[model samples]
Target: MADGGVDEDEKPVGELFGRLIDESKAYAKAELGLAKVTAEAKAQAAKKPALLGIAAFLFLQAAVVVLCITLALALATLIGPLAGGLIATIVALGIAAGLGLMAKKALESGQ
Candidate 1:
């Protein structure tokens, strides 16, 4: 805007630096906010109950398997070996089939 150049005394360095500092502060604040949001999002995802529920469910299934094996072994010892083995196999297959059917139905129903 100056025809050629202005005198050095007329230049306003203070105003220029003031504006730059304000813009820098705003940018820094915006970056800090973004980082905070990202950290919170990660923490919330980790804290979700779905993960706990899944771990609990897996523990329950493991307990059930151990119990079933113990019972089957006891039954086999009390009864004849052949009959006990056959009975345990049948029961295991039946449970597996039932679980498969339940899972299929749940999937079909979309929850």
Candidate 2:
């Protein structure tokens, strides 16, 4: 050993290590930014199909409503409005009562 065992030649190696650390951090930041952008794009892409599904469901509901109206109108044509209204109300009530009775029976049997 010479000059009291002091070393100054490792300074360049330390600087190079520091630079590598900084560069690695910058690369990781860039990759994270890219991932965020990709996720946003995928989310946006998914929204269109979701909206379309909602629109389709709404349209189907509207079609069912229209079909009911058409049936009511046809019944009105075959019978007078007063009689058609009475018959439709009776039919709906009968269906409801039947369903209720069936549910009661099923519940009683289960118990």
Specify the highest-lDDT model's number. 1
What lDDT tens digits, residue by residue, belong to model 1 across residues 1-111?
Answer: 455587645669997788889999999999999999999998899886878989999999899778777767878898967777677778878999999999999999998
**Per-prediction tally of clashes:** 0, 0
- In model 1, the clashing pairs are none
Worst ten-residue run, lDDT, model 2?
Answer: 1-10
Worst-scoring 10-residue span by lDDT in model 1: 1-10
List candidate 2 segments past 4 Å from native: 1-35, 82-111
**Per-residue error (Å), model 2, residue 33:** 4.5
Q: Could you give the C-alpha RMSD of every candidate to the true structure, in order shown? A: 7.7, 9.5
